[model samples]
Target: MPKPTVKVWMEEGVHSAIFAQQAVVGVFKLPQVTCLCCAIGLPPVHPNVHSTQKGRLLMSSITSTQVVSLSSQAPRPLPFWRRWLRKIEWRLLLLPVIGLLLWQGWVLLAESGYYADFIVPHPDTVWARLQERWADGSLVTHIATTLREALSGLFIASLIATALGYIIARVKIFDYLLTPYLIFLQAIPIIAISPLIIIWFGSGLASKVVIAAMITWFPMMIATIVGIRNVSTNLREMMRANAATHWQIFRHLEIPSAMPELLGGLKIAVTLSVVGAAVGEFVSAREGLGYLVMYGRGISDTPTVVLAVLMLTVVSLVLYSLVAMLETSLLSWRKAGKP
Candidate 1:
């Protein structure tokens, strides 16, 4: 038998394109065929050579049982747009593609003299600045500083907020006393009091972490209080009726019920933590992206500013994604249990 060449083709209604086995599958004789529409249990039809005589013969020889088996093995392909909608890769690319197009258009207009170049430097200019900073090794240190502050702040806030919120929600008396204090805290602008915080904590990592924690604590506290308090009354009673202890009830019932709100708060907290870290760095910092922003502005370096902003945006996105991923993994049971 001649060693056969095989081409893979899309089948109707499938989310993904699949290739046939390159080697012959005993009686299946996959390698003898030029195309594999029959392998996907479809009639021999191709946009190209998939509809050749060999494909038709392969399809014709299949018994009804084998056809059903093959069909069951692969879904029919969806139309191109449907395929895009069904998968994340293209949809995620869409916005970035549009943004890049708009940016390039602006760059073209600036180059054509419709807009001043100083208004915003070209993407090339920004890329050059990023490369320079990366090569100098400053970019990593700044990002690490900011990330360390933000993550540390978020961690501290989560522990304190969860414990305090639980106490307030369960005890009720502390709800009135502590909730008012948190409201007062949130009401105060972080910038207005940052100087005092910096003075107290010093112009170091301590101040940055304190500022980030202050910015993050209120929302997470609210989320924790709301989530714990919102546990189903029926569930509480049912647990009591079953003589479940407080620990078991909290572990099994309250935590699961409150997960949605807690996660919601965490999403908000993570982003705010980034903002707080930046604000702290803005007010007083030796290094970090915030420092880069200030340094760029001082020197009228648009590319440097933009690059720093983009890195900050990337950091914000990373923190948010981590929370989103955590939410998906933790609360997947709710989705799975849905009818």
Candidate 2:
């Protein structure tokens, strides 16, 4: 038997290095032994070690050098304004700025007498009409009335849609029985049936609420059904294994899973609710933004019509924003736990 020996090699100007040695021993059942040799020198080896096979050394060596480059460290932080502008919301402002430039171009063209006041009223004229309505309190009154109707309708529609959607999702019989009528209602334009709604509910707040609800119902219903159905089957099975009741399973396993889709549908429904309220007002109403538009058209007041439209746009945007805020608040856990 002869003592095993290791030879060392090095390159000049290498800052740091590591050397390791591994030995494998025995015939059928070999045990591995590793030794760490520092860069300064190799470790001392045992004097009485032997190999079982001739011309075979049960040894391996690995050498590694640590390289440190100054440029590869941390990067410099961006300037305050540069970092701020990199945000998505800040970048989105470019869209509205572009829109404003296009609108100014249109205003300039109108000022050049390229179009009649009735065709493209001056921005100042529209502003003046809006100011007049605001001063007379009519703008506030009309906006309040329309918002009330829209919100009321959305609340009622959400309740009905969510309940029916859950039932349809859970019960095959209800799905088969009610799906045809739901499709029929959705396919028919609300405007075509709005007159009948007005006739039944009369030209009151009840009719307006009903119209708004009808308009917003289908999207929410579909969203609820999809959301409920998409819940994990494993979770439902686990709940059943625990002997959970149907109500318990629905509350614990289904609703939370369905929230994202439900919120998405609610966003769409909230915006449509505004349109619904306006349509109801168009069919039969005396005091709303829609009525203002109708009355302005009858009197040939283009500025008033523009103002009413701007108010409607504002209302829709506000409602959509509220829904978005609610979604963010309720789904904060999802965002926090995102991969």
Stretch of 10 with least lDDT, candidate 2 = 30-39
**Structural similarity to truth (TM-score) of each candidate:** 0.72, 0.72
**Tens digits of per-residue lDDT for model 1 on 1-339?**
333333333434432223233344222333444345554446534222233345333322221122121133445657779867776655766898899898888678657865555566787888898999899999999999999999999999999998988999899789878888878878999888988998899889999999999999988999999999999899999999999999999999989999999999999999999998998888889999988888888888878888889999999999999999999899888798577
> For model 2, what is the alpha-carbon lDDT of residue 333?
86
TM-score between model 1 and native: 0.72
Which portions of model 1 show Cα errors greater than 4 Å?
Answer: 1-90, 112-118, 337-339
The model with the greatest lDDT is 1
lDDT per residue as tens, model 2, 1-339: 223234322223322222233333322212212111211223322222222223222332222221221121234457779977776586676989998997898789779887899978898898899888899999999999999999899999999999999999989999999999999989989998999999999987899999999999999999999999999999988999999998898788788889999999999999999999999989889888888889888899988998999999999999899889999888888877567
